[model samples]
Target: MASLLCWCLEAVLVAVLAVVGGVSGQVEAATPRRELVPAMFVFGDSLIDNGNNNNLPSLAKANYYPYGIDFNGGPTGRFSNGYTIVDELAELLGLPLIPAYSEASGEDMLHGVNYASAAAGILDITGRNFVGRIPFGQQVENFKNTIDRITENLQSVDVAQALARCLIFVGMGSNDYLNNYLLPNYNTRNEYNGQQYANLLVQQYTTQLTRMYNIGARRFAIAGLGLMGCIPNILAQSPTDSCSDQVNQLVQPFNANVKAMIGNLNANLPGAKFVYIDITRMMKDILVRPAAYGGQITCLPFQTPCPNRDEYVYWDAFHPTSRVNVIMGRRAFNGDESIVYPMNIQQLANLDLQPNNG
Candidate 1:
């Protein structure tokens, strides 16, 4: 009886310890963190756009109803129903939400500036169908203008050092595929095959990125194209109502080239550290369990979206919900090799990339 009592007591103690450990782990995760980097400069399309397109005369605007339904500040021109991936990423970095270049000024420009615009692409003519949108080439020019403003307050050397310490995230190429090549209005398909186009984009992209490095940027996180075929808009066009495999296969070359480009950039550019964000891999698990999320793929413009936004995957045919934004942001912040090549966002932020200043 004594031996049995001792064994029972040990089992009870083990269970109690396990419960306490689990609770403590949960609390630790909830703990607030300090800012990781000085600032984060964001550049991309509607996937990350936050109101830069609102004042533009582009037909690609999303500053209404279904778009900012979940946002604290309504209709911020983000495609999704609230916080974008960049917003979530800013939160993860313990930084305030970086303001759009259009609306940001004075102290707002200090933390960071988002240059992403709806319908923007790596190529100048990619989103012509939408008209009045800022292309990637012009966005870089806009950044130079921003640098001038930032220089007004800080010394030129200080501006360079601060920018080098900051994180520069650029997610391009989606519009290059969806709007430029695939659309009948554009002759991109006739001019170049998938491989050729990917090559052309990467070639141009190389120059744009080099310009960034020449100016000040040092730590970079370049986001690759995700599963564009898997988007609901693509699905709606599919006769079988499934992900278009052909479209998925077409963008692989672009993603692959971008990865190779990162390797080349890291090898040649001094003080430049660039990591590729594999968005396709980031969405893999979420894609497999579509049932857990609301099965709806497309949400019409101006129409009300699904009730439980978290349960939905695609906020609309093109963008993702706030739930996905947070998940992708968290993954990029801490995910392993499969998600972000060479290093992750958190690691990039921690890099002591104090520029030479010479």
Candidate 2:
């Protein structure tokens, strides 16, 4: 049955991509450029996690075969089979791929480090099911340690100046909903309605991002929540096998608050360029027409390998394939304001901010 499903999905993706191509014209490619940003510091959850979760005693790990089958280094711990969104973003920015925080040292810290851990969330307790995953707060602390190391190594390098000029990517909050509030065993749902919960998440998120700002992060690329209700895990719960409208609706406010937060941060923070990447819209666009994005709506179980990996939208029940990551990364890098509002990452990276002398 899995094989059949995989086969059908591959066919669907091929057709979808063809139709999408015919209608949308040629897809924009990421233009190679000189180092657009000084560095890219990443935080958040599995979506951007390269390998930080490998050593952690967590169930939310992807450190074995089939996980990095498409990636060159093989099971280096990215959730996807190949390059993550940050990896592609790094390429587009003309910087070397950002190393996972666990492995980074010396010169590796120069291009920035990725503190993203699979199963991480804005709230520390969000992914408690996974156990041992670094929370957003912890990731920030790890980044501070990285800064200390960098300063120690390059005594002449101005850490604050380097950070101010670098790009900070934050993609989180999905697990707070998926692994926390929505879980049957959790009390989060009883305490608050969807709107109230979203407010709570946003409040914590604001505090976390502010901490980053206080620590010298100035350029920000904040990815909004994607359509979690439409993922295969949620779809599997439905008797009709349809996307959960209720679940999808629940997350809309979180995305809205995130966008509002970006505006507020930009207005309040000196020299802060907070660019919002509308992953919600981008994923919906691809999900609505999987073929166009070379993605399959359904993913086979992790143990079962799909022959046409690039054609599948998702690699497992929750994460997108490396190909889809590339697609989304490229869009975030150069897509118009409709997809990545205010400005895309490319534009944000190239933006020159007046020194925050204050």
Best by lDDT: 2
- Cα lDDT for residue 60, candidate 1: 79
Residue 339 error for model 2, in Å?
1.1
Cα distance off (Å), candidate 2, residue 259: 0.6
lDDT minimum window of 10 residues, candidate 1: 1-10
Per-candidate local distance difference test: 0.78, 0.80
> Which residue pairs come into collision in candidate 2?
16-291, 16-292, 17-291, 17-292, 296-312, 296-313
Per-residue accuracy of model 2 over 191-284 as CA lDDT, tens digit each: 9999999999999999989988887889999999888887767766788767799999999999999999999999998888899999888877
lDDT of 1 by residue, 190-213 (tens): 999999999999999999999988
Which prediction has the highest TM-score against the true structure? 2
What is the RMSD of candidate 2?
4.1
Residue pairs with backbone atoms closer than 3 Å in model 1 (clashes): 294-311
Q: How many clashing pairs does model 2 include?
A: 6
